[model samples]
Target: MSENLWEHRPESGYVTGTDLAGYRVEAIDGHIGKVDKHTAEADGANIIVDTGVWIFGKEILLPAGCISAVDHPNGTVFLNRTKEDVKGAPEFHRDHHTEAPDYRLTLGDYYSGRVL
Candidate 1:
């Protein structure tokens, strides 16, 4: 996985300290869901999307690197990934999704194209 996979790109329009909760998450294909939670840690930024009925309410974690842009004005976050990409990610485990290194690696690998 890439070293910067967890850091938002400079051009992604994500301002540090910005609260992304509730922002609509849009994949390359279409709307996926809303942001249930987010983190802005310098080395561990990411978003947890609540997929609602689209995937039986499954929540998926996406690395900041997948974000192509953040439209705060419209309350939407654009991702470079497709809907299938987000859908195929590991399911969010509320208990260990945040602090688990293995979980992060799995996510990073999935998003970085290292894992199929």
Candidate 2:
């Protein structure tokens, strides 16, 4: 039980969008998928990004610590992670929001890729 690596402080917004629900996760690299939902907790946020977002392109998880900022412009919410590392992230599911051990391990593995 430790502090979350990333938190949407009252002073900040973890994810910004013209309309949270309107945001569609366009495929990572010409693929087709969009985030469906997300849940943030002390451990981290479980993002239900469209499974398609895990395509053979960019668009991957952002370790809580790697997040330098969250920007929403032109109806898109953008993250700062590089396209290469993002492409290498483990497969993510948009339906696994229950937060389980395997998910946590996958998340940890995700963080490992954040800074590399």
The numbered model that scores best in lDDT is: 1
The parts of candidate 1 lying over 4 Å away from their true place are: 1-3, 114-116
Query: lDDT tens string, model 1, 38-71?
Result: 9989889999889999999988888888988999
TM-score of 2: 0.52
Clashing pairs in 2: 25-34
TM-score of 1: 0.92
Error of 2 at 6 (Å): 4.7
Candidate 2 residue spans exceeding 4 A from truth: 1-3, 9-12, 15-21, 24-33, 51-67, 72-74, 94-98
Question: lDDT of each prediction vs. the true structure?
Answer: 0.87, 0.45
* Worst 10 contiguous positions by lDDT, candidate 1: 107-116
Instruction: Write one digit per residue (lDDT tens) for candidate 2, span 46-96.
Output: 344454424643234443443333444643434444544556666554356
TM-score of each: 0.92, 0.52
